[model samples]
Target: MIRHLVLFKLNDGVRRDDPRVVEGVAAFRALGDLIPELRFWECEWNISDRPVAYDFAINSAVEDTDALKRYLEHPAHTAGVALWREFATWVIADYPF
Candidate 1:
């Protein structure tokens, strides 16, 4: 199994209700359909402590490294990137288990 984790540092003045935030969450949830190897997924909007930087984080599990790679490069992911690129900074990691 492989785990894929992503964190997003939102842009200035951005809020959880912003369209970009809404779309980001939806995109991550929708990824399971396009990437069949997604074994499990979770996305959270940061609502506590009010961090100075990020607004949300996403954690996902896949069947293997290859699955992680495919999810990373999927067109749906690319589309999501294009949609939120201007308002977000993201980080990703893949770990085998």
Candidate 2:
């Protein structure tokens, strides 16, 4: 299996309650159902108030590199990325497990 993880830090002025962010979160939250390659999925707002913590996170898994590619290129995921692109910067890690 391959694990995919992403952590997002909101833009300077962006807040979790912003309508656009809410929609973006909803979009990402729907991705597991929309895509068949996902074997595991979890998304949540970060509870940490520490200086280095990201504001949001996605933890997911797929069967392999091919499945991972499909998930990344899926239209629903692309759309969600576009939405989040406007409000956050993120970091990602993917690895075989």
Local distance difference test values of all predictions, in order: 0.78, 0.97
The segments of candidate 1 whose C-alpha lies over 4 angstroms from its true place after superposition are 50-53
> Model 2: per-residue lDDT, tens digit, 33-78?
9999999999999999999999999999999999999999999999
Whose TM-score is greatest here?
2
lDDT of 2 at 59: 99
lDDT of model 2 at position 30: 97
lDDT of 1 by residue, 1-97 (tens): 9888888887778876888778877887777677777798777776766546466777889887677778778899788778778678888777887
Using all chains and alpha carbons, the TM-scores for the candidates as numbered come to 0.82, 0.98
Pick the lDDT winner. Answer: 2
Taking all chains together, the TM-score of candidate 1 against the true structure is 0.82
